[model samples]
Target: MAPGVNDAIRQLILNGRLNATSVMMPAAYIGADEVDALEMLNAGTTRAAIGLHVTLTAPFKPMSNGFAPLRGGAFPPINDMMRLAMTRRLDIELLTIEIATQLQAFLSAFGHMPDFVDGHQHVHLLPQVRNAFLRVVSEIAPNAWVRQCGRVRAGRALHDPKSLVLDVLSLGFKSQAARHGLTTNPAFAGAYAFTPKARFSRIFPRFLRGLPDGGLIMCHPGFVDSALQSLDPVTTLREHEFAFFNSDAFLHVLAESGVTLAQPSGEARGAA
Candidate 1:
């Protein structure tokens, strides 16, 4: 959520290399410049889809009050939040209120509903949290689709622990969305070890191996700055991803993989 990252995404949008991005409504670094850039791009003929990136973890403060579990006005870490969600210990009322607040913030800033909705760190797929998230989206932005991080096919990255965990958590998520009268992506990819030595160029093609049409592939392509380094451990890889996506190699890979970037469409209430 740093300015550098925003710049990278803006460039990607301008170059037609990126089709969609979710904005973190509560990020402190988001200012008028970033909003103006997004507004210009969104209002222009660019096909970029902007959505809300619901955040409920550390390094960001909560938007709603009465979160008894918060620590020092900040949301808990991802692991702790996961435990509470899985065990159904989270206060659903407070979580729902916070999500709605974030959605309102997005609407106030953009003057329109998000094109889609997803969570920061995939929190929208978790247990108690999912119930609250889907309900809020259905109520506040029924036209927006939600992200479902479940894989549709086995591939080289199938064994990756992070992918497996997301798969498990995403089981029945689409059905849940449907019950809420929402739509979700058919499949998902783009999980990898964010290690310093990891080469995004080499790992990205694996995400395309079996991705279905309208599938969603998440990526974090950004530039590193003091703010980014202070808030996240995934610094260098962002630059690596940005380089790959901004390079001819990315075009070659997409051509070789027989892939095309298209905006996902649906008429159902709350489709992604």
Candidate 2:
């Protein structure tokens, strides 16, 4: 999550529309008061779990600068990094250091380990990055879980090819997590191609219906701002999501699908 990412999400958690969010530690938008308030609101309810959104791509600076793969002190684009990994061109030692540094940043900012961890563009599931992630978690945050992207069948209106590619990339993630004694969400949804004209109202209901019980659905719902637009290409879609989630339509769909929001297991739990 970045600066404007939290506003609508905070409302969703409080209003019972969303239950989880991942935080980007290095983003300039992090506010101590906001995070503290969120923790307070979730104290007993466990309506949401704050997770670390590990960033290993550009438009932001790396916590450590000496990493060999970094371009101008920031990570290169996702595909380029993947190419480097596939060709054995990345520095595994530097990758290890960067991963450790981000985890440490998470701890420092949150004052405790994050409830879970995942990558910005699913980089955590990549070749060398996966090894570095597992190693760091095993040493520093052995009990905290991780997010694993899983494939969803293509529905009429919701077809995100990139999400499918990511799911295929992370095919053995659950088994690998189990091998390392780390828990993970069983299923995943909420991937989109970020088309400006896409109607979330049509797409979201289908998504909820297709989702399995205890499955996890990631979402981005925020008021768009210059900062957000500058950082992300999926700007308008976020507002669309925010509006859909807060509407009565969303509630009706959840009830129709027998989907009740619950915090992922392994955290504090009570009435939300």
Candidate 3:
């Protein structure tokens, strides 16, 4: 969800290669150039879907303070957060406040609510976080669709454990969002193990084949810089993805797969 994390990603949007990106608020604030780049991207005609990337875990701080779990600018590991969820120890109120704070940050930077919202590591789908996320969006940004991770389809390799785990969490998420009067992308893909030297060219076409009509496939494509390399482990792969998507090869793959990239229909997007 950290779309403005680096220039390469922003340039992809500017060049009409990527259709959607998510903002990681603190990252944008800390590196204001990223925000500036986002402004440039938004000014263009690509109509890219810009969304918020909710961060509620380690390596990043919560937008709002005074929450016991994040008191010292320290984010617990994912396992700890999951444990807290299982024990009903998460402070839903604090979670709600932090999410709202991030939403406000997006509004301040972009002059409107996000085109959509999702968690940095899919945390929006986690137990307490999911509840807080749904409630806050329903209040402040009811029109924004939340990402609903659906099952990985047959085209993906069977050994794709990361995608499978995401699928399990995604089960019934659409119903949950619908109950909150929010909409979700019917399916999701573009998750992987991030193995070294893994080729996007090989896998991307498979994902295209697997996607259903109106499905959303998440991506993290950019040119690797020192900043991105430091913040994300999956660095070079971003360049690979950027290359493929920006190339005629990508268009060929889409043609071969009998699929095309398009914005979600207006009805699914709601008011904004």
Candidate 4:
């Protein structure tokens, strides 16, 4: 998640300072670098889990060897896709092709299915995208894991999400996960915008407290590189994410909250 310095992010996670990461797929990727990184991380048998940051937006380069037909030589911009999703005119066929292609590319590089799957803009929860993504994943890798967008209330510091259209769409996707016997977090953390001045230890506890036990905690940690900054304006945010998640404060939160980062024995994950 670094500003093009993918290695920095991987190093921290491997050193046991961070426990989770997501990958940008078929976008600005130097084909197979992700696989190399994933394999290297998994070799340590670290608790760190890697999921696809399924890319459909972000003005960046698709892996030179990617599987999508870029419209006008760039991604169908994120906003455009949102408009299409809203207008019911998105290119579902290409969406399916892109997801399937990214998954295959990831497997080719890692030699296994991804640890989990999500999306760059929560697009996987959209209708045509969800149906298409589920179909591709279930068809190609039925045993693979997928992330579900689960939100539950502990208190009201975080505003409750109130988009009925989004919820209805996500519910259908959640049901699809159940139908396929996939696992998801019992609750999700509110993704705050990144702040450069933040300390990892200080910021993580509140997020930890907000989470219900056993669901996945998503964090983006990366190196800040000029290339990455050019592509991802929020590179500094993830640097803070890396610093915070790796901080002693986060571990203290885990201990105090009795939150287990990974389930023992690979059993079903749920709220405590």
Candidate 5:
């Protein structure tokens, strides 16, 4: 979304610790230059998996038009979107068009299908939204895996309200994906309070605790720039996460946890 984020991801991929990332097609900085740079970076050797980050929330304009629910020419906030989805008030047809448009943008820019697909704010898990999302992915990029936020193991963070809520919403998601002939990650982690005082170095190890082999851990590591600050409240923490991941301490933590970085397999039973 921002140049800082692009730089951070490029560095992390070069660092050889990160494996996959998703792109926001509607982001302001995502244009010809950025796409060219990313393509060049991904040309040879073992490039990181790139996927579409389906966006249907604030801070971004819709790629497709005729959305009756948009507020001020922008997608509504996550909470409002959730409410609309839960109440069956969302315009599913319009949502599907928007998603398809975004996917088309990704395909147009990358000249290939995404390795996977997921929602920007986990919006793919919402009721009305999930149907539109899955349908679009199945039709446009059937080979891509989808993200499901169900945790397979009970860890200390299991009781955390955010984790519990996501788990509850994720019930029957895997089966839904199967019905659509799409695969999903087995488990998920990496939910935390993005407070200004939070230390990612201390909080990240806990995300690995009890995480299954195929579990996916979400993260947002980036440099702080004016563009990023304008779009997100999760500002400083991105720098913190980037620092931790870029440091030798990250390698030490992985070694201590007996974890090795690897790409998710094609059989849909592993992490990416």
Candidate 6:
């Protein structure tokens, strides 16, 4: 996705079709045109929170130069880090350097501090990542909010096996965030495993009804242009996601469900 797609999503959110968007900053589209993102933000044309969509994946391409500790020169870059971390192969110094690099990149690209922090593919929640992530969060803004995927309300039946993994990961994440004084949404969304062509109108609203106010909803919306596809494999399916999320149905459901849209405002949890 490029400036065109991001602008479209910003419009959709302004029109109240979607709630939030998590972006990959160093991934060209957002990074290539940080000025555009900042302009939209400064104008308040988009109200969704802009968090650090930390990239540890996409190895063959590293995003920044200043941050160290991450291993580059491989495909799906962060995969190496994850593999090492899981198998006890990660170097603590490298991990620290890489995260710091990402942080510096975010500030440079966006030209201000992030409103909250979350990982691309939930990387920030990983065991090794959580430790490094917190230190950065505490240092960067100290009071800016952070995101934890934990779902607090009980008695909800989780269907997918992947959800089970998320639940376990989120549990630990929530604890770490609090220890660092990072505020998080009571719920987090935006995990669509199936193809984006799959109908999301019903699915999205059901999830919205469950959305706790003063929380966050993560969404990936982009056109499946050839350029994007070459850069990222799932660009084809995510194109549908862009259109669907920006649709009239997406907005209607939220209204019907009485969901409120809010953006975090530093050290505060909002409901509206």
TM-score of each: 0.95, 0.90, 0.89, 0.81, 0.95, 0.83
Per residue, candidate 4 scores C-alpha lDDT tens digits across 1-272 of: 33345766667766666555667766555456565765576663555666667777657445444435466666777667667777777667777777888788777766666667778767787767777788777787665566665554452343434333334556778888778767665666535545566565565566566665566555667767777777766776766666665667666767898876562222333322
> How well does candidate 5 match the true structure in TM-score terms?
0.95
Each model's lDDT comes to 0.84, 0.75, 0.74, 0.63, 0.84, 0.63
In candidate 2 the C-alpha lDDT for residue 154 amounts to 40
Tell me, what's the RMSD of every candidate?
2.0, 2.9, 2.9, 3.7, 1.6, 3.2
Question: Tens digits of per-residue lDDT for model 1 on 1-272?
Answer: 88878888989888888888889988987666777888787563745888899999988888887765887789998999988888889989999999999999998887888889999989888998999999999999998988888876655354589988888888867888899888888888888888877989998888887877787789999999998988888898999999999999999999999998885232322211
lDDT of 3 by residue, 147-231 (tens): 9877546645668777776787777566788999998887787787688868888877667655777677778877766666556
Model 1 alpha-carbon drift over 4 Å, by segment: 156-158, 264-272
**Residue-level lDDT tens digits of model 5 in 56-137:** 9997889887876888999999999989988999988999999999999999998988888988989999998999999999
Q: List the residue pairs that clash in candidate 4.
A: 2-222, 2-223, 3-228, 28-61, 200-244
Instruction: Please give the distance, in angstroms, between residue 82's alpha carbon in candidate 6 and its true position after superposition.
Output: 4.0
Question: Residue by residue across 1-272, what tens digits does model 6's lDDT show?
Answer: 46546766776766655545555655666654554654475374445656666677663245544443444453245555566556665555555667677677777767777766777667777787788888888877675666776543541347755556667888888888888877767776555567645665545654564566675556566665656656556664555666776677666766787865664344434223
Q: Model 4, residue 138: what's the lDDT?
A: 77
Candidate 5 achieves a global lDDT of 0.84
- What RMSD value applies to candidate 3? 2.9
The lowest-lDDT stretch of 10 consecutive residues in candidate 4 is 263-272
Model 2: per-residue Cα lDDT over 1-71, one tens digit each: 45566778888888878877788876778768767866775777767777878888877777786877667
lDDT of 4 at 244: 63
Prediction-by-prediction clash tally: 3, 0, 1, 5, 0, 10
Candidate 5 Cα RMSD after full superposition onto the native fold (Å): 1.6
